[model samples]
Target: MHLYERLPIFVFEIEACENLTYITMAIRFNLDRTGRHLSLKDWQALPYAAREALAGYIPGDDDFPARLDQLVSDHLGRSPDTAGDAPDMAWEDTHALPPGLLAQCALADLAPPSVADWAGLTPFRRYVLTKLSRRTDKQNHCFVPAMLEFRLAQATL
Candidate 1:
């Protein structure tokens, strides 16, 4: 059985990154349990805590290949033959950024070496950040907490 389908989280691009002996790849999930798959890039861009509570990877794992395989088999039972890609309609709008959200992003503390990597993210990721950073009186509790969580996750990753 192929590895991705066996895992509860369906990740793509399982490859050894650069010269590193370890493997690295982006993972995707039908995370809401609704069969709606979020892109791996978008998934990683989400707050790490949420990712963990939702579908977090094991941290500081040394034996990743075995760990990943076992986790997949335990979670998903079997790998499927098809690796589905998003429909063409899923591309981002990539329009001009709103100044208000840009100001909010300016305040985020990304990991030091990659500080302010916000603009480097894809348009959809930027849109999600904008939404999370939006000022809201009622949902302020919700978005505010997410912003903090995203920062914390950034540090660990």
Candidate 2:
């Protein structure tokens, strides 16, 4: 079983769900590292569900480091202190855009208006929207609407 399987899961409220009592779930992982050691590449490589599940736990707090340590030791069967080493590729905002989105930006020629609008977005928001845009099946519909909303919001300023 995967390490996540053994962890207790909890349902959390999400505004995206209109009627559902629980729109998201979480599985706490045990690791010594906090958000500082996490990489965007590592996060993107995770399955969508796992990514969402892990999001709640990413923002480490007082007990988080210890919990992470325990998770690594328990799941990976590694030593508690082993997770302190950062991944080879460090996490950065520039690398947050998925490949397809980067291609789309290239194709669209990313007008100054769009670039400016996108630049104004918070890193997290930009990350999410870029990922959404990068998806192969729904890129146009999903990304265009988000872009429009972003543009409209920017126009108000």
Candidate 3:
């Protein structure tokens, strides 16, 4: 059985005033390795409609990795084009941390001093590292070094 097969397909409710729309979406696959449940904001980053459609269609017997690859490809293919926008997608300091346990990774000592030293990374980068650091196994040692490297690279500029 694949990861998604074991995971649950949830109904994501987007409310507009008095109306409530439930979109069937598989927001996560592995429960233990992938960590806690994802929120609406995280799902928003993905191709929402595609996920919703696939959630109902994918067979339980299908190959796990292949299905995941297809899901990712379909999701990426449906992404909105933002060619004219700025090419860089690094994190900025302003991007707010995701709720719950992930927030704890953002505190000093957990993150590297270099990451803290960076002057003006885009919110996306901050979000990436923040999220990655929290989700990754080496919550302390790894993130600190990665942050230091990021900071060092930034300092050369």
- lDDT order, best first, reads 2, 3, 1
Task: Score every model by TM-score.
Answer: 0.24, 0.33, 0.26
Clashing pairs in 3: 90-125, 91-121, 91-122, 91-123, 91-124, 91-125, 91-126, 92-121, 92-122, 92-123
**What tens digits encode model 1's per-residue C-alpha lDDT throughout 78-119?**
322233543222113344444434444445432221324544
| lDDT values for all models | 0.35, 0.39, 0.36
Model 3 misplaced regions, further than 4 Å: 1-119, 135-141, 152-157
Per-residue accuracy of model 3 over 53-110 as CA lDDT, tens digit each: 4344432324433443455556544332222423222333443433312433444334
Q: Any runs in candidate 2 off by more than 4 Å, and if so which?
A: 1-16, 20-98, 104-117, 137-140, 152-157
Pick out the ten consecutive residues of candidate 1 with the lowest summed lDDT: 25-34
Error of 3 at 34 (Å): 18
Give the TM-score (vs. native) of candidate 1.
0.24
**Candidate with best TM-score:** 2
